[model samples]
Each structure stands twice: as structure tokens, then as C-alpha cells.
Target: MAAAASLSVMVLLCLAAVASAQLSATFYSRSCPRALATIKSAVTAAVAQEPRMGASLLRLHFHDCFVQASPVPSLSSLILSSPT
Candidate 1:
């Protein structure tokens, strides 16, 4: 049961990554580059903190966080993305 939930989470994260790649260019037109840089750094740090995750998974989460910051991609977009 736990493993099934984990697989579901992975599927959702992959979907978010694809969605983010599509949304990022549209949303960042007026945004400051420095702000984006800060977000990217924070995401990298948060992903690095996960002990059980492999490097590729950590990188994917960081990439996803660049645009899909919220777990569900809405009001909480300021928060970093997390991988299960």
C-alpha cells in the first residue's frame, strides 16, 4: 500500500514537470531574474536534504520547483516542490 502511494506520487511529480516546462516561459516575462535565481537555489537546497532520493530525482524536483512550486500548482506556488 505504501509503495503504491509512492508510485502515484512519482507519476504526479512527472506530470507537474511537464506542465511547468510549458508554463514557465509564460509566467516569467516580467519577473526579475534575481528572484528566479533565489527560487532555484532554494529548491536545490531542499531537494538535497532528502537522504533517500537519488540525484536524478532530486534534480527533477528542483526543475519542477522552478515553475511548479506548489504540490498542486496553485496558491502555494511560493513553496518549494517536494518529491516522495
Candidate 2:
């Protein structure tokens, strides 16, 4: 059961990556050189604080991609539109 869930998350990530046109390793190199490392650090910190947070984030990503056809703006709107 856990393995299947892991595979589902991986597949969702791959699908999102493929669907995104401008997505690339160096997408933020010029604009935000430390973006990847910064994200990694944050995720590491969150996971260290609570392992389930990692899975929650992955699920969030999957839903974001599933609901929003586009990546950045839609996801941002989806998140921001929520009542604080």
C-alpha cells in the first residue's frame, strides 16, 4: 500500500514536470540561483520537524497540478484564495 502511494506521487511529479514547458534544472539559475537549494533546505527542515509534512506537501503538489492546468499562477491563486 505504501509502495503504491509512493509510486503514485512519483508518477504525478513526472507528469507535472513533463506538462510544464519552461520547467528545467536551470529555470531559476539566472533569476534565483539558490532557489533549488533553498527549497530543499526548507523541505528538509519541515520533514525533520514532522515526517508527515513531507507527504502532505507532495499531496498538495499533486492536487495543485491536478486542479490547475498551469503551474505557478494557478497554484499561487489556489493557495492565496484560501481563507487565512
Candidate 3:
């Protein structure tokens, strides 16, 4: 039983690794050639405006991951909102 449990854990880890490996740096290269550079510039500008915003962005990522089904949708909503 112990060996079976160990094997199960190993299998799950391997599957998770494979899943992550499927995400590539060039995943959007063809679709959006400047995506990485644009995101980097935006992040730099944001952090320049507010140093703590970098950590806040990370916290938002965690919050979206835990509280929402997906980060993109929640982030998109936030991005698209207009200030009152």
C-alpha cells in the first residue's frame, strides 16, 4: 500500500510537470509578437509609479488563482473597468 501511494504521488507530479511544460515562452510569439516586451514595459511603469504595486500584482495573481476559476478573466475585468 505504501509503494502504491508513492507511485500515485510520483505519477501526479509527473503529470503536473508535463502540463506545465506545455506552456512555452513562445506560446504567443506568432499570435502576439510583442506581448512579452509590452507586458514587461507595463510592469516596469507600474512599479515605477508605485514600488509596492509589484507585490500587489503578485498578491492579485494569488487571489485570482484561489478565488476565481481563472486569472485572465478576473484580470481582464479589472483592466476593462472604468474609474468612477
List clashing residue pairs in candidate 1: none
Model 2 bad stretches (over 4 Å): 1-20, 68-84
TM-score of 2: 0.53
> Candidate 2's residue-wise lDDT over 41-76, tens digit each?
999999999999999998888987676655434435
- Clash pairs for candidate 3: none
Report the error of model 2 at residue 46, Å: 0.4
Which 10 consecutive positions of candidate 3 have the poorest summed lDDT?
Answer: 70-79
lDDT of 3 by residue, 1-84 (tens): 556555655676676668755678789999999999999999999999999999999988888767775423343444355243
Which tens-of-lDDT digit does each residue in 13-49 have in candidate 1? Answer: 7877787444566476476657777877776786688
TM-score of 3: 0.53
Error of 1 at 21 (Å): 15
Better of 1 and 2 by lDDT: 2
The whole-model lDDT of each prediction reads 0.61, 0.74, 0.73
